[model samples]
Target chain A: MSDRKNLNRAVSVARGYDPYTSEWLEHEFESYALLREHLPVARTEQLAYRRQFNGGWLLTRYDDISACLSDTDVFSSQSSDYPQRPWIPQAIDPPSHTAYRRIMNKWFTPEAMTAMEPHLWDFAGELLDKMLQKDEFDFVADFADPFPTVIFCELFGFPLDDYEQLMDWKNTLMHATDGHSAGRALAVAKAKELGLQTPDEGELPSEVAGQVYGATAAALYEYFGGLLEQRREHARNDMISQLIASEYDGERPLTNEELLDTLFLMFMAGLDTVASAMGLIVKTFAEQPDKRREFIALMDDSQKLTLAVEELVRTHAIVLLPRRVTEEKEFEGASMHAGDQVMCPTMAGNRDPEQFENPDEIIYDRVPNRHMGFGHGPHRCLGIHLARRELRIGLQLLHQRMPDYELHPDKKPELFGGMKGASSLWLRKG
Target chain B: MRVEIIADKCQGHGMCNMVCPSVFKHDEDGFGYVVAELAEVPAELQDEVRLAEVQCPERAIVIED
Candidate 1:
């Protein structure tokens, strides 16, 4: 087949670009390469109908994605109306985004993260002790999922007892389509609240998934709403209470709706991304022993470990940031219309050849590594410092417990897309 | 070289602080700011300061020679 034909085959959105499938995951890098070379801004007929918006342009190069993210006025994060409730700071543009960010930033600073390190280390050790007891286990389910989720709960002041429930709700909201079977039962239960009676037996329709997400989200809002009331009465030294004590633009207290919106955003963002990153990182290590050894070597050295974390995150970049073009204009030979959805998949940008030398390879000490795994610009990940701390502690403890881990020969990692990670990563220690 | 962070442009990615903690420190809100004690980028720390300037995703860091 001609290179162009192969490129077309790889980049065709109509071919059902299901990220859950190994085929799609395998083609992803090749497709990114082809798109960057021949069509940096390629239009898609559909973008996984499961996504909030479909049929838009995909920006596959580093500079273009960076430009799109940096130029927030033109490429707005207020992209979709799907969720209906806007995630504060994430969905809100400028002035408002700034104000919202300010209200929450202090709780996630490097100093706060540093203060939380000993607790994190203890927690990681606790989890690893339990995990290493089993000869073989699903890393995503066993360690990765609970590690970040539990830490986030502790930070947000959610009862540690509710951690399992919180994880189920999150999975229902975010991983329903990714074959997370645990989410299915919870989705059905939540679906009842939405008056949705058993959404068939097999694959949930996109509409049903939307309804389930809404129902799950409402549960979270109510959960946090109650928590907010308690914090209002008597503030605790936790993020929720801190947010309650915060002022918006120094003018007034944040509205209940605003607080809920922000918490909702935090709930989703805090629980999933770090866990997803851990899953991806470990899965990579399981498949590639040499990379694992290199990473293990850096575990004791904080400086080298920091650089290693950046590179692993860069290579396994999961976010596919969507933006709405605010005005019609020509951009890099593509005629973009106002309100058109544009996807800036950070994976493509992180792996763009023009930006990084040997873009696909994970060089633990890649200098000047300005990869946007946590994103860029005003809406960058609020919990970045916490995330870095988590990765460092998580990896350090994991390798210390099981230095010779590998992918289970019988079971394979189920790669998920749309804020990508393995839904299930089976591993065995040698 | 004197270094400063343009507070308006900083969204608190903290790359400046990460790359050069000697010159850059984060506020309680994680926003990067040059250390008040450091009136100038010390000769020893200039290279790290330059890297911080380059690494600031928001381009909020500035150095005047």
Candidate 2:
């Protein structure tokens, strides 16, 4: 592969292998496979490569990706220290990460998430009912986006009315770095259009964009603060109240900053990741009706739900875990510097042929499944249990309620952002 | 038997204290830092300790027999 000097040869081969260039995000899957096939880790001198975005190291091999995640000390989660509102805690490394994570862990446990099953099911059911009422609806807007957003709102004890506004803010925030000037400009415009004003807007004119960008932060902080105050007076039976009442290290109460940051992280991370995954899962099932029927059949058998959920996560890993090298190290013969960023694309890792048989195909009952869909080691997704519970309950309810659903032929599914997942997947219910 | 926890891995999910409250306790960080090591394992609490092992989401605890 190295002897072939023509780079276009590889690109041409990739295009032939995956014909859906128009619809796919970055032709990422094809390129990932090509890179893995050619060299497990290959360097690209592409001008589009930005240092901040994974620092140009894309670990395409499964073992290499897994090794990076496990070695958290050497490979830090502090991918960038740029001053921006931290909407996700997974971006932070240990020590400080420890405290913030503790406050939020209560909300994401299997037990906590299991309790949310009924609510999530109801959310899915209600959304599906609305969709079934219409002849055709945008799957991303009507179902995929709303399902996770509503769940997140409920989890944070926020009003359901704020779902649309929250979704728009999150979308803008995630794609901010792609086109810095344009993205920031769009964010400011959105804030104005939404009639949302930030608290810091009055004090610091220089940081108006920062303030505007962090308006959601202010809103969240105020919301959580009110709940915390209420909980301090008298604890409610909700996750917010539980967090407010939680004692860190033992006797120390969480600071207001810690509480708000943790809540914001959960809200932001939960929205796109789960929604995108759900969209892809539904799209995958729609594309393969046989697999859809098989999944439905498994749903009928109570014992198979866990296996089905595992397979779904494995098959459609949307979020790529990004890590930075905290120490100079040699990994798989590559000399990684202390500041270099490594993007562990879970989708690529999960689909490595060396790890699983027929890596691309969705085997609904593949046992001994150890995919990094929820990630690995300590920094693994805290909300994974909730994500699984939500997915399992949502899918089960969806299959049971609308077993004969099919994708609308007229509408093409939009892949969300640069992430390897669907944004919208329109389906017609029978 | 006593259990030692790597503090860094602990997220203070409270599975340890919830399972074996007599053995494990939360520290200043809201995480379960080791409290005490029991000399003789009470038969009743053995299941509780095992429950802690399974329930700990972080997998930060290791038990010494």
Candidate 3:
């Protein structure tokens, strides 16, 4: 068959299994492996297979995706023409995006993250101690969820008591991958339920369309208004306060809107990505005892935990970076048009056989490890240093305290919903 | 090892000076201007140097053997 005919056939086969169908679990698993094998770059009807908003093209090939990430000129980050959610700035192209990023970059540096380490360790240790008392607990809900949640709360000076509520909102937002509109509706609904008016469903007198547009702006205005006020009065060594004190263009500081938008981005970007990664890390370590032991040995020998954290990120890349095509571009002979959205799957990119030997398997000491877990180029994750520290401290303490931890065989991990995480990863503590 | 600073990229982040004051001192520009070179770094200061390297916002400084 001709290439076009072959492409058509492949697309049909891909569409045969709905990417969002929870009932198609077997098909989804088979497709994940099959797509990687067959058309690693083939198109699909999967909403996530393409950019959710504009039906733009998605590129799964490792090299093409990386190139897209580095080449920001052809891709725009502005949400002006595209249909996007409120917290989409991090995924936008650069230049304009850089201003917002600059406002909050300092708070996520290694020094800032290190300063927050004591609090993170205390939180992780407290959670682990409680889990150890039970000796067997759901890893995702009991451990993975709380690790990033508490760390983020303490780091930003937000109340730790709000973690569960935040997690529910986050879950609603992230797990809507399949049912994009419905999922987002549910997320907005949940956000409203939490007394925060979402753009889609706020109690404004405006029309539904206007409400959708104004809800996020209004809610954020109110949320950060209070925060900005609090920080201006008493600068509490937290992220919000730091940003308030920060000067841009040698001016006073970031505006209230900017602060709220960034904080919202932080919440959207942080929670699930780390939680998913933690689940993957625990699951991977549990499955491969030798590798886990090797990680422990590396931590013990180096006494510097960042190396292990790097290895963990390299091994299981959680978030895939998405970019939009601004002009007609051809990558590897595939003609991509202007306005096509491309996703650089960091997991797939990190596992490229050309990049790493035995790409599918985890290499505990994968040296010369230059993976795009945080991404490459200017728009890389601002909070990467902080995330790395949290991962290092959380993993090290967990291993040291509960050395003989294992996945509980009674409860098989259910990888359902829109998340690629184990629903309930039960573990037996040492 | 000597530490070199590329001033053009430096945004006066102050992270380097905060991390390793002895090894790096800020100039009038407010950016970190490396002031010292040591062939052998003390054991206590190793973490400080590593932290400085990791914390540099502009990635303007390079430590070489």
What TM-score, computed on C-alpha atoms, does each candidate reach? 0.92, 0.75, 0.74
The best candidate by lDDT is 1
lDDT of 3 by residue, A346-379 (tens): 7666666666677666666454455667665566
Displacement of the residue A18 alpha carbon in candidate 3, Å: 7.2
Pairs of colliding residues, candidate 1: none
Full-model lDDT for every candidate? 0.81, 0.66, 0.62
- Global local distance difference test of model 1: 0.81
The digit string of per-residue lDDT tens for model 2 on A1-430 reads 4536435555444333321222345566676787676656544323113333433466778788878887879988867543344544677776666666766665565455566777777778888888768876777678777887777776666657776556666655554323223334456575676665634222212244454556655655676677678767876566677777777766687677767766677766778777778888988888888999989888866446666777788888876676777878888888877777677778888888887778888887664456778776667777776677677777888788678867888876766434545656777765
Q: Clashing pairs in model 2? A: A248-B28, A248-B29, A248-B30, A249-B27, A249-B28, A249-B29, A249-B30, A250-B27, A250-B30
Stretches of candidate 2 off by over 4 Å are A1-26, A44-55, A81-88, A175-188, A191-235, B1-65
How high is each candidate's interface RMSD, in Å? Answer: 1.8, 6.8, 7.6
Candidate 3 deviant stretches above 4 angstroms? A1-40, A48-54, A79-92, A176-222, A232-235, A303-305, A416-419, B1-65
**Which scores better on DockQ, 1 or 2?**
1
* TM-score attained by model 2: 0.75
Second chain only: TM-score per model?
A: 0.92, 0.74, 0.75
Q: Give the DockQ of candidate 1.
A: 0.59
